[model samples]
Target: MSTIDAQTDSDATDVASRSNYELIIEPRKGLQLFDWKELVAYRDLFRFLIWRQIKVRYAQSAIGIGWAIIQPLFSMLVFTIIFGNLAKVDSDGAPYALFSLAALLPWTYFSNAITDGVQSLVSEANMLRKIYFPRLMLPLSAVAAKLVDFGIAAVMMVVMMIVFQYPPSIQIVALPLAIIVMLITASGVSVWLTALAVQYRDIKHGMNFLVQLLMYASPVVYAASIIPEKYRLLYAINPMVGVIESFRAAILGTTSIPWDLLGVGFLSGTILLITGLAFFRSKEKIFADVA
Candidate 1:
């Protein structure tokens, strides 16, 4: 009986030790570095989010993806009438319509990225409350979804350029750099804005107003040359200045690639990306709680 009692006591202790385990998961206390390994592990989730955004974007709509082509096309027409015809905005000797369309392509992508991204976190509040996934995925997927729209708009651009009798020059090689800068700027701004919008809620409402204000600040409808030469470098800090101007130079193929503008814009975009990531990570902890 004593041997049996000793064995029973030992068995109870073993089971108790195994059952009394603790696991804690939360955002870190100090500097919060992104966990790349964990994100890679969640790649499937990221891809699914991206696809879901693209599908749901036009699910119940009649025009479907035609909305993509219509947005910039209508904006270009409006700009041509107002700025190109009325104001006589310079177009670097190309048709004003094509010039504005080029800038509008990237600008539209940026605008859509911000408009959707700022809402990404707040819109998914239920998922945030119920599940544990990388919150960064929300904004990233939002930005990526707009690329499909950009692609459709770009095809329209190609057709218009051909109709206008404009052809791209060898300088088209630099087009990819312009696009990369646009993506960097969009991602950085989206991340920062989305992070803040999730917490404050007011940022969500003001995003459209902010984007409208920013469009005028960029070279979307007007040429950067309208600005005094002395202010070019200062103005290039806008990031989109380099992006839009570079797109024109590359796509329109009239001007040589603006290496100087590209350098300043790329540097500014890089700084924005780094600082935005830092801010997003710092605020990551409060998202679940406040959200």
Candidate 2:
């Protein structure tokens, strides 16, 4: 056989023997919505990013995960003194420490998630440039990493509840739902802030102040009952309001479930998630270029 024919036959045999695997790349046109299928296909990358975030979070830190418990625990103490004692803030009949800690758990998670998620892209700029993967994974992993901290801090909250003699009640059944709401809310805000942070670095600088304001705006140190009845619905528009209130009710066993407020929070959080996903996906194409 001719050398050229033999080479052609060899190439054909190699192609036929290889397993069928194909990847296509195309220039995206217009706004790209969230593609769960693509995200699922890249699940390994997502898991790796999450693991990297968790490792980086505790790396070189002497105390490591202990920082998680310390942050909210100390914040709860200061709030207990200033708001619980000095200002005489009401806690809906629950002990001030327990009340504040309940709210702080979700708040700390939300705030850290946003703060880290916002910087996830910028911080991983080298990876962003070196390889191609779902840009959403960076921010999503950042938010997910906070769950570890949240879990650690939660143990302290349980210990605090025991110290305060607060027992979980039927409302505790809704704790998972409340936590989902918080995650959705935090993920929405994180994606939005992360997309923006890619273009404007100033977003990172303003985050601390923004988080502080949001905490005060939320029911962290004070009870939702303190808000007048008329403005209660308006207050519920803030997603954290319902989340924090629900946590207090579930963990501290204080008030009954606030279905109306929770509904409002769900609605607002849904809107944020949709809009934030749209914005993030829209900006995703340019991330490598910008980052």
Candidate 3:
């Protein structure tokens, strides 16, 4: 056996035998179990991990942070031409460009976070095999880093709002809640995907295509109003529908709060968050060995 394995086995046995002679410790399923306190103990590493992700994200790109602005800007232009001009998509009385950009702001953040976060653990397998900080930090750091991009994109949205002469509503105060909804949705999916990713490497590429398809399916270019009233609830199951629509309502002052859709999103997002955290904790123990 390897030196580390020998030492670990010895220590585990010694501790168990000392605790109770009559009792036997058995292996548990679900891989690494969740340790809420342990994650908190490594808070410093969490902070550094978040910072490192940010730097690594923008370090060498010629456009640097400008990619954030360009992304939504380009999306808005394309959406305007195709959906606004060609399809004559209804935009709830707001200019199609402004309407689409508001939604794209949050949609971009959610898509990027999971798209990158799912690969965080697998890509850093070498580090995982060596270091002992909480494995959860890797996914969390990936999600956190995407917030920088979200912030830059948000600024661009505000600039466009002004240029387009769209005024904000009193609902603007709820903007942070909309952002939080998108973050929770992204992080929850990240936790599940990151854990499974270590076991299945093909998921990394598959997720990229899946996320792209999801963007077009979402309300990035069109308004929720286009959906017939009968199917609105069914459509909102995407979770992102509510998040994007709510963000647009707050900024553009046109789309009213889609409470029914928001309710579905909030429920789905919360469930996903809990499920992801539980699954991540369960499989954490295998990460160091597998990675």
Candidate 4:
């Protein structure tokens, strides 16, 4: 073969090989649920996003991450005084401060995750317009960032448990499940709110109201036992009710497993997650234009 012809054949072979390796990007049609492989491929980007969120949150604040510990601690104190002393709310045989703090650990994380996650896409609008990555990463990173705050607040919870002389029990084995429940519930709501916030700026204000209402609706300031048995199942649909209750049961070693309520919470959270993902995916295509 002539050298030119040989080179032409080699170039054609290279073109064929490159075509096989080409990645095609196209607009998704109708409720495409998840892109697991793309998400996995972007794992490094996801990690960086989570880290960036954590650092940016406390970057220039005077108290920095200490806000995490202080916010929940102060809230626990007020609840102890108001609900524990005044209202005479029951804490299921544990100290009110400890009870409230246990619930607050998960509650604070969830609230913060949703509040920040809802705003993540809008806040990162510059990046959204300029770059391409999994839109899920934005809200997911926001929720993941609160885990740092959760960890910090949790240490204070342990300290409170020691002060109250409550030791860890075998039930502590369930703590991971409790945390996972909180994460799922938070992420699910965050996904829904984040997607909505992009199209409706009013959602940001409504979110504040929703979070406050949810706090009261859940058992944050009181015990689940105070909820009527007949209505307890209805209350468990809130997801956080079981999560906060389970936290106290596992950590404070107070109540029983409350399997029925926990089951309701898990089911509700799973449904929220599926629906939220579907909604987020449907709206994701327009994020650049709307965000």
For model 2, the superposed segments whose C-alpha errors exceed 4 Å read: 2-24, 28-32
Q: What tens-digit string does per-residue lDDT give for candidate 1 at 7-72?
A: 999999999999999988754677555779879999999999999999999999999999999999
Candidate 4 clashes between residue pairs 3 or more apart in a chain or in different chains: none
Q: What C-alpha lDDT do the candidate models reach, one value each? A: 0.90, 0.90, 0.85, 0.90
Clashing pairs in 2: none
Query: Per-residue lDDT for 5 in model 3?
Result: 100
Task: Note the clash tally of each candidate.
Answer: 0, 0, 1, 0
Query: lDDT per residue, candidate 4, 1-291, as tens digits?
Result: 999999999999999998899678788776568899999999999999999998888899999989999899999989999999999998888888888998898999999999999999999999999989999999999999898999999889888878878897678888888888888999999999999999999999888899999999999998889888899999899999899999988888888777777889999998898999999998988999998
Give candidate 2's error at residue 61 in angstroms: 1.5
Give the lDDT of residue 85 in candidate 4: 98
**What stretches of model 4 exceed 4 Å from their correct place?**
1-24, 29-31
Looking at candidate 1, the ten consecutive residues that score lowest on lDDT are 25-34
User: Which tens-of-lDDT digit does each residue in 26-63 have in candidate 2?
Assistant: 87777666778989999998999899889988999999
What's the residue-level lDDT of 256 in candidate 2? Answer: 90
Give the RMSD in angstroms, all C-alphas superposed, for model 2: 3.0
